[model samples]
Target chain A: MSTYRVVPAGSVFDRFAKHIFILPGLGVLVALVIYPTYYLIRLALSNFDLTFMTKPVFIGLGNFIQILSDTYFWGALGNTLVMASIAVALEFVFGLGMALLLNEDLRGGRIIKSLLIVPMMIPPVVVGLNFKLIFDQFGPLNDLLQRLGVSCVDWLGNPLMAKVSVILADVWQWSSFMFIIFLAGLQAIPQYLYDSAKVDGASGWRTFRFITWPMLVPSATVALTFRVMDALKIFDVVYMVTSGGPSFSTEVLSLYIYRTGFRFGTLGYASAVAVIMLILLTAIIEVIIKETRLGKRLEWE
Target chain B: MKVKSKYVKHCLHYMLICSALVFYLFPIYWLIITSLKFPGDVTASPVVWFTTKLTLDNYRLLFGHTGALWGAKQYVGRSFLPSIAPYITNSIMIGVLSSGFGLLLGALLAYGIVRFRIGGSRLYNWLLSLRMIPPVVVAIPMFTVFRTLGLIDTWWAVASAHLLMSIPFSTLLLIGFFSDIPGDIMEAALLDGCTNLGAFSRVVLPLAAPGLVAVFIIAFLTSWNELLIANVLTTTAKAQTFPVYTTSFAQVERGTAWGPAAAGGVIGMVPMLISSFYIQRYLVRGLTMGAVKE
Candidate 1:
């Protein structure tokens, strides 16, 4: 019985040995994360401009008050929500369709599946640059449209089209990510469930709705949460393609913070915006976790 | 009747798959072809779908060996333009070091969590939340701190920032891999008179090699492709990455030099393209933060 015990109980060295494995990693992570976060909070509460050589001037809640009155901040916040929702919704639909199609176990499926991963694997900056070329005035897309007797529309120049183009680029790159996740979910489903469903003579749609859909909830939650989180921080694509576009119609919150802090030299106000963004993200994700009961599923045994 | 119906369904599935592939592959195809085209052919009307006149002038221009005088002259006064070689070197150096360090730490942390149950679910949740924090939020303060330490524009500044981003993600990923390894193996090693560190290195690390590879690739790629933190931390070619250099084309005032930019984009995408093929099996597991294991 004593030999069967895995947790050592003999010596002081044995008692403290476990901490050795974790302390180095966790210590580095904590040290790296804690200081910036602390400084970020401190900067958020002060007036620290990069352009000025003077020390920060502490101002209580002033930046937050200014944020409340700033229409640009509100517009950027609105754009972030709208873009994330629309792009994620489209990605979910297209990804699910792709997953279902690929799940059929057709001939040459492996090749097609590997090819599908290409867009998602490439850098977001490259995706943006690729789309920028394709959306150019005389590029392939416009030529194709013109050949089809449709007019060539300005893609990045017009504000509405710029938003549409950004969403399109995002969907093009990320739909494959959702597809991969859903496909994994689909594969994880036991074949016996379908076998039993077939014995009962259930229709395909009914089997999917009752069996597949319910089984797929966990994967859907993960894909949606990650995609939404990533879409909210959509600076690279927008930075390359539109740079917040023709009259700032596509300036999402992350890009807004970048412009404020780096471009315009207003570190304190940008830090305030960033703090707000962090809180909003945490709150939204918490609601999502609670609503989906993902927290329950994420627990360790 | 059932056989015919199955045939029709197969046809429908093939059609859908083909169309989706076309939608996904066309832009990539365009990017590659544009890189091979001359400036005139790139913007040519009718889209120049097939040009026998494909040129590597863009590549030559990017490598700074353009024998074409005009291409050389176009970039003569552009001091801000980055030479592609040094930036690529910087990216590789930073990516390898940061992700390497991230893997070492993450593996140990994951091992501790799986075996000792040190932090449990609460700690796991905190790590997950750390992964969710926006890069911009971290970028501002990291910039300030690095500057104060006089570490700005060095590889260390960018690599350390990237390490912060990679650690949580790598730990989360490695946790799934470590959990899959049965505890009996560790117990067996311990019963053989091995210390915890010895058992971890000799027995566990070998078993987790595939997972470690996958995590390293993903972490390296994340650092390689990252722009916001890297952009904030490094200003000169001394430590800037390929993505930062690629973005400079977008900022070129006279209008983007699409040919050279496309060439650079193609170069930047090659490693990931090759890596995707190698890691296809592990990608779903890695990308979802190990939530959905295949």
Candidate 2:
């Protein structure tokens, strides 16, 4: 940082070099993020005639209005929220438990830790497609249940189970991510904390509640916030597995937008949906980010 | 008494580990099993049980007979071909190109940010915020933009879109890496014949090799596994990736061809799974970077 360059003022090459990357970087940001967002909003507010692409009509809030009155939109929103809420909560509890287990000095812990991250590494579409096969009427899930002398229930066939099935797949892949974060946090806490607590006559439960839970919240917050944001935008799994389902039961917001834009060619409606999703997600993420290290802890990591 | 307490602790840890192993590994195990089974036998073994026969056809088909991907039959378009093979190649190509490009761009920007103290730090943090924003939010908008630009269904389109996540993640990691290289050392480089860029390219970069390598692998893996945008943006094999290759198995008439799809799924993930576990240390370091101070 203290390095001084004494190039004369007339050295245009160095001057260009100094500021060269700035404009290119800005250009990249706009092209990659800002422009696409702009065009999407434009399309959402515009008119699309089939024969000829119509001049974009300025229908103020009309698309949002249609979205508001549409029952499918509401259903999609509800399903998306339910999926995120359930998946995130499950991942938190499940991931916390998994982290605790992996932290143990067990013979198979390494193998288990390696195995745990396998699901997340799989492509999301494949995860959805794989689950699609698993959830079939005579799919392995049912066959397995039948083997246990229990009657098989319709998985994707039923409205509720479809959502539950996708949630389960998400929890399967991502709980490990949460676990990794918590494990890191746990590793950061000195072993002596537990030893000290024991010396102070703190019961195991008391030590866990006071030491583990409180100390781990910052890490938990990072993991949970990430999972929650991702779960809301859950598309690949839903789109690949159900394509919004037997009765549109599994159509989260992203799926709805995907269908609206690509399948039906309703660019404006899809754009509006996309924008709403972005705005809503941004608001939620901003709040969640507050609890994360970036906003709260204020460190590079 | 101390020995007894240690024994109880060990027992508790064992109990927790066993239950977690079973629960966490079940679904993935089921996927692998299903991939190895034929359609009829997919459910023949209990939902979570092992089947008597294990076949390798699913894995075989994706590796496909033809190397360059030729058309078996004429379809709607002038030159529609069997996508399964080409799709794999396309995915690999896109993954390599995008991640390669992303790494270069991310590293250079991260270097400038870290070394020169070029821009406001908040802007750098905001980039991390973008990293956190789910791709779904950007996917739809970008889909429209790409479509308009005639870049839809192209490799570059997908690659550029990936920058949205890769840049910020790379910067965040690189910032920590660069900062860890004490200011005194960078100043020493300037005292030599090294310009900021030269010093960065020659000295700082080599020093940050571990971080760069970790970032490269992660970026590559993410691009390889990406599905949502790829599925929407690309309709044909020309730009489609392996992740979406299985979706084509779902013909409107057929409910879903589980055998081929699961087989494809397995093929696609195997490379990633193998490398990740082998490089698990780097992956963990990459993920948990910025976490601990040097």
Candidate 3:
């Protein structure tokens, strides 16, 4: 039983000692993240196309000019925004509905919740493949349609339907995610509020409108912020299912950047595309965080 | 009449849940059924709902057992890329390596921020914002940087890229969890003459072990499910992960091979499905990054 000795609290060494703890993480973060991001911004400003050179030549926003002029850039950006909004909207509706239903006191509720979340947990590529199988011209989706006395639709081949298919697959894969978040939000509402509402003779819809909806706002905003950011970065499912195909109809920003960078080896131009995405991503996040009042809430917390 | 109406409402509620369940479950069910079906039955028109005759040919092909399936047995030896076993191994290795690095550095950073109150909420917010930085933004520059360093196509390079992902996530999560940890315990440890590092390792670490496990799972799964970095980074099976390998089957020149690809899809998804059941609560908490707690 050796007696323990305490280190001095306000010693000069303590100040420097904190930096030791900070350095390991800070070093890696700087090396792997900060430097790379810095390099990316620099590369974005250069004629850094790997196909043409061993070293990136500084061109001072030539790549940005190129990106602005490129028709595909605008197309891809429009597609990304559309896909994100459509998928997120559908997911919210379906997810909120399911969350409400699941919130009820029901038999095997936990099991059902777990099963529902399976889609969200599976790999995106696998989700893409499963949807591809389902939407095959001769597949079960068409089979179900035919059985309903409807003509079979070419779900992935037709341009409009292909976009719909991509969104459908995204919704299928993530609505459960929204469901879980909404369920958590719903559950987090104190039972006493409902009890007080009941004592006030508040009707079901009115209670929901006055009490539940407001209570859910925080979680809803959090969920939507996460969903929108994730949806905007849609790449895996698109790459897996359509490869941004039927003539680039589903070519979202990430997929187009990936094609431009990797396949064509135009790293400079691709970096420019990525920098724009990064800016947009930052702006979207900033807006959402502010609009949701989440930043303030977080600060107070 | 009142009781009957209430019963009918309950029935409708159950029906709605059941329909949602089917819509969610059918694709998974289809993948499994398709994986079990023979190659010929996979693309069979008027879609075979169920099959009486199932074959393991897809799984066999996945395991490089193509001696009899293809007439030229020699082609079997060269069938390296499509082999499912290595891809699974690669995925597991990358997942483990990335998570290991991620959790180590993340836990350390989180402890520093929490105990030292370094930068306070601002630091935490800055770290969380790092997560919003799209991987595509850094991918190309990172690619060129790694290429210069001669780390391109290496497992370490891929793991390092994924490490960037997991750090912010785990750090943010642990910060939330650490805030919940009673501060008096750390003060007690400090007064007991344990150094700050000692307090973290012996005191806070044991308390936060479950959270670390949860973060590891999240980090591992995120890395496991990623395709773009793996696709761009690794050119060969040596470092390419399961998602990247499985993706090749979807875009094969000969046309998509439905049966084997379905088998791979089933195989790829199984581990996640199994792990998800155990992590459901942790997952929700992690998914929100402790932004909205349960």
- Specify the highest-lDDT model's number: 1
lDDT score, candidate 1, position B74: 57
When candidate 2 is compared with the true two-chain complex, its DockQ is: 0.44
Q: Per model, state how many residue pairs clash.
A: 0, 3, 0
Judging by lDDT, tell me the better candidate of 2 and 3.
Answer: 3
Each model's lDDT comes to 0.87, 0.71, 0.83
- Residue-pair clashes, model 2: 3
Q: Rank the candidates by TM-score, best first.
A: 1, 3, 2
Residues B1-294, candidate 1, lDDT per residue (tens digit)? Answer: 999999998788788889999999998888898899877787777789877778787777787773553455655523444459998999999999899999999998888888787786678777877878899999999999989999999999999899887888889888888877887898898887777777789998999999899899999999989989989999998999998888877776422588788889999987898788768889988887777788
Query: What order do you get sorting by lDDT, best first?
Result: 1, 3, 2
Q: Give a tens-digit lDDT track for model 1, residues A1-301.
A: 3553654555665566679889989999999889889999999999999997456789989999999999999999999999989999999999999999999767888999998979988888888888888888888888899999999999989999999999999999999999999999999999999999999999999999999999999899989988877888888999999999789999999999999999999999999999999999999987876686554554355
* Comparison by DockQ, 2 against 3, better one: 3
Q: Model 2 over residues B173-284: C-alpha lDDT tens digits?
A: 7777777788777777767656666677888889888878778778778888887777777877688887777666654323234555666777777768767855566554
Across B32-75, the per-residue lDDT of candidate 3 in tens digits comes to 88887865677877788988777766777788775775334454
- Kindly provide the TM-score of model 1 when superposed on the true structure, using C-alpha atoms: 0.95
**Residue B246, model 1, lDDT:** 82
Range of the 10 consecutive residues with the lowest summed lDDT in candidate 3 chain B? B70-79
Better of 1 and 2 by lDDT: 1
Q: Candidate 2 at residue A149, lDDT?
A: 95
Stretches of model 3 off by over 4 angstroms after superposition: A1-16, A296-301, B66-81, B253-256
Task: Answer with 1 or 2, whichever has the higher DockQ.
Answer: 1
